[model samples]
Every structure is written in C-alpha cells, then in structure tokens.
Target: MSTFTKPNHIGRKISRIRELRNMKQEALAQALGTNQQAVSILENSETIDEDKLIAIAKVLGVTVEAIKSFSEEGMINYFNTFNESDNNFNHYNTCTFNPLDKLVESFEENKKLYERLLKAEQDKIEYLEKLLKGK
Candidate 1:
C-alpha cells in the first residue's frame, strides 16, 4: 500500500534552502528587489506564491523542486553520501586541458611577455644612445 501526501511549511523550506546556501534574508530580499522585512514575512508564512517562489529559487541557485522537498535530515544524508569514498564517481568530470600542458602554456606566455619587454627596453636604450651621439 502507498499513500500520497503534500509537504508542509513551504515558506520554512525556502528559508532553510536559503540558509544552506549561505545567504541572508536581506540578501535574498535584495535579489528579489523587495526588502528584508518582506523576506522575513515571507519566511514566516506557510505558503508562497508560485512566481515568487521561482524567483527566490533562481536567486538561491536552486531549483524550485529542491526548495519544496528540502529537509534538514535529507540534506545531511545527501552530504554524508558524498563524503564516502565509495560513492564518489567521475560520471561527468572532464578536463579541457592537462594540468601539465596548462603549466607549459602559462610559462610560454610569460616568456613571450618577458621577451617583448626586453626588446622594448633595448630599443629605448639604442634610441637614447643615438640621440646623445647626434647631440
């Protein structure tokens, strides 16, 4: 047997997600183009408008569903799962360039810049010598 139930305290869920993202109510209010007091009132309410919820979720860098289904224990469990080495997987990890190649590229760029500056200084010295000889 299975049961269907609706989640409660949607506003509190939004608040929890915001806090987890290291955001303050005032910051969220700024993102929403409202004010801190409005944010406080929103956090204290039971329900939030759908459009505003979407806006808040975007500002918090999360999906609306994430805020809707958020719970403290669930978040902790999710983080713990990542801490276990066995669960670590490189499913989508890709590197555009090898680290050694990147280092070589950076060194080459710096070498080119140094060469250009050295040539400039040499040219300036030659120009000054020519001016003194003419005088």
Candidate 2:
C-alpha cells in the first residue's frame, strides 16, 4: 500500500532537475535561446508558456511530467524512491560567485587586517617594555 501522491506544484521539481544536471540558469537560458531572468522565473514556476516549458524540458533532459511533479508530497515520494547520496544535489549547486573563490579573494583583505592588529599589539608591548626599563 503506497501512500505517495502526485505533486501539485512544478517549480521545485523543475529547479531540482536543472540543478541535478549542473546547468546554470544562464547556461539553460542559452540552450533554450532565452534570458536567464526568464529561466529564473520559470524555475519559480511564475507563469511560463507551453513552448517555454517544452524547451526547458528538452534542455534539462527530463520529461514534462517530471517537471510537473513538484508538489511537497511528490517531492517526498521522489526522494524516497531515488537513492540520495550526499553529492546527489552537487550538479545543481552551481554558483555565480563561488564561496571558495570569494574566500580566496578576501584573503588579502584579512591578511592586511591581521597585520595591522599585530603591529598595534607589538607597539603597545614595546611601549610598556620601555616604561618598565625606565622605572
């Protein structure tokens, strides 16, 4: 006796599939010959035309039914049916600006701050040492 039901919402499912394929919104848009904003809107399931939906499905390598089955219950059932490893969502986790890249970028900024603080502390220690020597 299965208690699984179909999804009422489609946005989440579409988004998941897009992500699973590791396609960025911009890349998907390029494949569909559409804009990234439009792709974003479609992922959110705002209000896309039939042609757009068909194109999206084609680009995402999934059936229209898979995209349409995005309701909460449907998502739960889908996950239960599919074997979800930790890296299952890795494909869809593309970032416009990667966190590791950002961290590397800010490395110099952090280094400068640390150097300034270290110099200030050294100056304070030297000043205290001079006062003690005088006493």
Q: Write the per-residue lDDT of candidate 1 for residues 58-109, one digit (tens) a residue.
A: 9999898988888888989988888775434654466667999999999999
Kindly list the per-residue Cα lDDT of model 2 for residues 6-65, writing each as its tens digit: 444466667777787888889988998889997788777745667777878988887777
The CA lDDT of each predicted structure is 0.89, 0.77
Q: How accurate is candidate 2 locally (lDDT)?
A: 0.77
Cα lDDT for residue 63, model 2?
74
Lowest lDDT sum, 10 consecutive residues, model 2, at: 5-14
